[model samples]
Target: MTTGALPTQTLPELPRHDHGGCINKAIQIAETLCNDRGVRLTPIRRKVLELVWESHRAVKAYDLLDRIKPLETSAKPATVYRALDFLIEQGLIHRVESLNAFIGCNCSDHQHELLLLICNRCQEVEERPALEVMNAVAKEIAEAGFHVHRKAIEIHGLCAQCAALELVR
Candidate 1:
């Protein structure tokens, strides 16, 4: 009932578009961008991106490899890792440091900071746009003579649905 809260009723999944379309479009867009930037969107690399975009949940590399099993059959560990590195450099995905996992990004065009809201109980991860908060933090750090080259902001807590369920119990 409160703001930023989901109802107590358990939902199988969050609101999602047609996954087939989502993945396909994401691939097309990423490929287009890579072409524009003169980056190589190799077959293995494209497969990795597809695997990450298969779900909204955080996906570990091992699991990603498993999902893209065909790629694993041909590509070695180094190959997959290198493909992941390329995708990361291109900003096609976001890495969840706490979970040691990767997730496809909704923000594919522009660059911005992300605040991860991870559920301690269910481990559901939500990405909240964190421009203002990160900006403020950066300003404070700058005043303290600190500079940040990279940031993976994670705020762990119960999700709204979990909180509602707890209240009911």
Candidate 2:
């Protein structure tokens, strides 16, 4: 984890890579956004974001709590939940409904439809900003007489690398 200001990772760069650089970029964006909105990026909140972006896989709140204990001795379930809520509200992270876990947002520049390509074999997730698809879905939902709110779509399958590995074996 970074001890000071976080690094910046551009949107175009997040999809095909997972490393310390990507996490740092996300943290920097979150920090800037919070600052712009006059929201406090508390230590706990920052830590929660860091933990969520530790890998491409989504992280459960309880698992986040367990990880926080060593750094924040007094950390509780509620505390972690609050941090998760804050991150979600800020668009710094997203909750995976199917998996019941959270993953860092790849596109924090603006609100758009997020499509997560989840690799079943490796548990890796890649974020795709699909505005056109989201708009079409919204139209269909409206035709059904339902109002729209937040949008997240998850498609589960093997990523290219994993699929290739399977073919090899």
Candidate 3:
């Protein structure tokens, strides 16, 4: 069994930051990973990934489809879903179950447990590699003899910027 390493958590400054870098880095990582895995990152899949990396916010499938239609006129719901499925399979993105939305995975280098911090006010989702928390959870699951297939801990609250804004208000 491969033990996942905890990545350094750097939460973005929500008010101001170079988001273009985020999008570019994500695309580059996706391209490299696809090449390494000998899988095709088709045009549609790449575009879907780009759209998902547009921000740190969670986006709905229908929203992605609507945004993609302008660029990919032939795009349909199935097309978007297929692209989403492929991205998920490749560990390039994550599905935010609570909001029924998707967000780009910053740490796509390896498969690891997810700890998402979602801001209720701004809807931005931050992914944290809580290694200790996950290890504890794993221990408990093992004690219960539960075979875990997938695990993601989604905690919804105010992000730093939103919380600060609330304080001013």
Give per-residue CA lDDT, model 2, range 40-97, as digits (tens): 9999999999999988877778878888999999988898899899999888998887
The candidate scoring highest on TM-score is 3
The top-ranked prediction according to lDDT is 3
Candidate 1 residue runs with Cα over 4 Å from true position: 1-17, 165-169
TM-score of each: 0.80, 0.86, 0.90
Per-residue accuracy of model 3 over 111-145 as CA lDDT, tens digit each? 55889998876788899998899889989999999
The global Cα lDDT (0 to 1) of model 2 is 0.80
In candidate 2, the residue pairs with backbone N, CA or C atoms under 3 Å apart (3 or more residues apart, or in different chains) clash, namely 9-25
Q: Decide which is better by lDDT, 2 or 3.
A: 3
Tell me model 3's lDDT, rounded to 2 decimals. Answer: 0.86
Provide the RMSD of all predictions against the true structure, rounded to 1 decimal. Answer: 5.4, 8.6, 8.2
The TM-score measured for candidate 3 stands at 0.90
Worst 10 residues of 2 by lDDT: 3-12
